[model samples]
Target: MSWIFLFFAGLLEIGWAIGLKYTDGFTRPAPTLFTIASMIASLALLGLALKTLPVGTAYAVWTGIGTVGTALLGVWLLGEPATATRLACIGLIVAGIVGLKLAA
Candidate 1:
């Protein structure tokens, strides 16, 4: 389904984002390759999802999932900041994503 593709695309977006952190400005060959692969895969999946989903809504939800997922991964795996405000913002993004899904 388009929604399933979109979900994995969003997850791949998060993976590519985290991979970007490891790439070290593209100096690291393996991580850079991983990042590029994930990026391409994510975009391709997004395109597939767009075949059925509304463009604006799908895009917003995709980016929302990526943003929130990456933030959470950063905190949990990358030792990024975990302040209450940051968590609240992530929650708000989640709420918006849920709202968009519901509306769709």
Candidate 2:
């Protein structure tokens, strides 16, 4: 299904985002390679999903998943701040993503 592809693409978007952090300005060879690969895969999958899904909805959902996943991962794995305000903003993004899905 297109949704499935979109969902995985979103996950890959998360992968590449974290990969970017690991890249250290592309100085780290391994993480940089991983980041580039994931970035390609993510965009490819997004293109595939665009065959059926509306572009606006798909893009928002994709970035929403990436944004939420990366923020959570930053808190859990990278020791980023997890303030209530930040959490609230993430919740709003979630709501918007869900709303787009429902509208579609």
Off by over 4 Å in 1: none
- Residue 101 error for model 1, in Å? 0.4
Clashes of 2: 0
For residues 23-80, could you state the per-residue lDDT of candidate 1 as single tens digits? Answer: 9999999999999999999999999999999999999988998999999999999999
- In model 2, which regions exceed 4 Å deviation? none
| For model 2, the run of ten residues with the poorest summed lDDT | 1-10
The sequence of per-residue lDDT tens digits that candidate 2 reaches over residues 1-104 is 88999999999999999999999999999999999999999999999999999999999999999999999999998999999999999999999999999999
Estimate every model's Cα lDDT from 0 to 1: 0.95, 0.96
TM-score of each: 0.97, 0.97
lDDT of 2: 0.96
